[model samples]
Target: MPMSALRFAAVAALLGVALAPAAAQAHRSWLAPSATVLSGAQPWVTVDGAVSNTLFYADHVPMRLDGVKAVGPDGAPVAIQNGATGKYRSTFDVQLASPGTYKIANVSEGAMASYKQGGETKRWRGAVGQLATALPKDATDVQVTYSSRRVETFVTAGAPNTTALKPEGKGLELEPITHPNDLVASEKARFRLLTDGKPAAGVEVEIVLGGVRYREKGPELKVTTGADGVFEVSWPEAGLWWLEATVQGADASGARKSSGYVATLEVLPD
Candidate 1:
């Protein structure tokens, strides 16, 4: 199945085989930046967030900005300005006051559970902390799953730096072997996949370019991580690209947990 389909399937199957690979869904979520690299005393980039049937095209619902955040080169929180939601998409602006890279992300974490209460099945979804109190005290045959998801993009003011790229050591994350803002067509870019701070080998990554609305069929490229949890991609041309990956495992409490990551990157002409 296409990565788009897997996203929805993963959520619906969270209590079953959470994060299991599945077919494509009708919509895909993404974040697109107006610019990935800039030069000036202070630069800014506008980002569009949406979940559309066509990649990067706002033909569907706007992505919620409640979890959106930005981090500067110094590992300090950067402010997101002029955030707004429209009919089909959400827009936000970030100021590149510092002369280095910045990471902008929309993150969400929650737990899903199903139980039998009063001889009826009940379903619940909420933050991990609220799982305990939200569920019935006498609920039987209870099953729970935790999930984390992140959608993000990178922008550089002067030169790209890694400080903002540091992983939080939770959920699925990208560790760039090749700087995200430095991607070039025909040149290979390497990245490592991490699951709970450790290498996540055998994970599959799906790459697709934007402008699918104008094409008869969108082409998707797939790659799998090696033992080192690293994978490489050679861009076919210059444009905005969407990459996604998902992994499932167990949390500290031995409860089933899953993580999904999506990133938008720009590839420059060779």
Candidate 2:
């Protein structure tokens, strides 16, 4: 059954799972030695191993495997999709564009829960994989990381080039938004803040718009970020104010940097 998004504590309690309060304080995970690598070049891969049991009732969390440019042999992150009854698989047919050492890794973190009894949540950190070896061997199958644990990667040395056009989707594009001007409370003015080219939420924005050389009562308002990364401030009266947003990331250490864009707007009688 599809799960409804629930609060952290509520989800954990009902799901009979644990939640990592912060990225630093991560939960231990179970990893499986089983994995695959596509030989060649291009994008990077994320290292994954453990059988992460996240979400409401599902035994393992559905994860999309990404690649990293690890130095070792010729390999690229394989394109992946859901296969047969909850199992995810990667398809690599490009045929080792280049033969050299390739690195593999996983860089993702997610959590989900069930909708039964309100909601149950399970939290886990994905297993960190440490696989390294050379590619394009003479044998039909070869092991890269562990000789005792031979993994088979389909790469035929000196194999004939068979190029085929495959349909692929490009990754998403991201941009950053910038603005000028802040709002000062005494002066009446409207204001908004943006981050990463999108509306940022859970941010403490400062308004310092109007008001000039003359001194005025200075008061900073603490505002939480909305999903759209936007908030409206109605001017109590006409004045100037400045605008700025506090930088806060996933961890406490990530909170010190500030990258807020400021725009000035006027609020008049409705």
The lDDT of each candidate is: 0.86, 0.29
lDDT of 2 by residue, 1-270 (tens): 233344544544322233321111222121121212333344232222322332111244433334311222323353332222234322222223354322222223223322222233322211213111111122222211100000111122222221211101111111112111122334433223344334555655554333333455444454555676555564555432333333433324221121212222222233
Put down candidate 1 lDDT per residue, 1-270, tens digits, no spaces: 112344544655532235444214556789999999999999889999998888899998899999999999999999999999999999999999999999999988888777777887667676789887887689998877888888999999997899999999988899999999999999999999998899999999999988867677656789999999999998988889999888877767767777888899999999
TM-score of 1: 0.91
User: How many backbone clashes does every candidate have?
Assistant: 3, 56
The root-mean-square deviation over C-alpha atoms between each candidate and the true structure, in angstroms, is 4.6, 22.5
Judged by lDDT, which candidate is best?
A: 1
The collision pairs in model 1 are 4-25, 5-24, 5-25
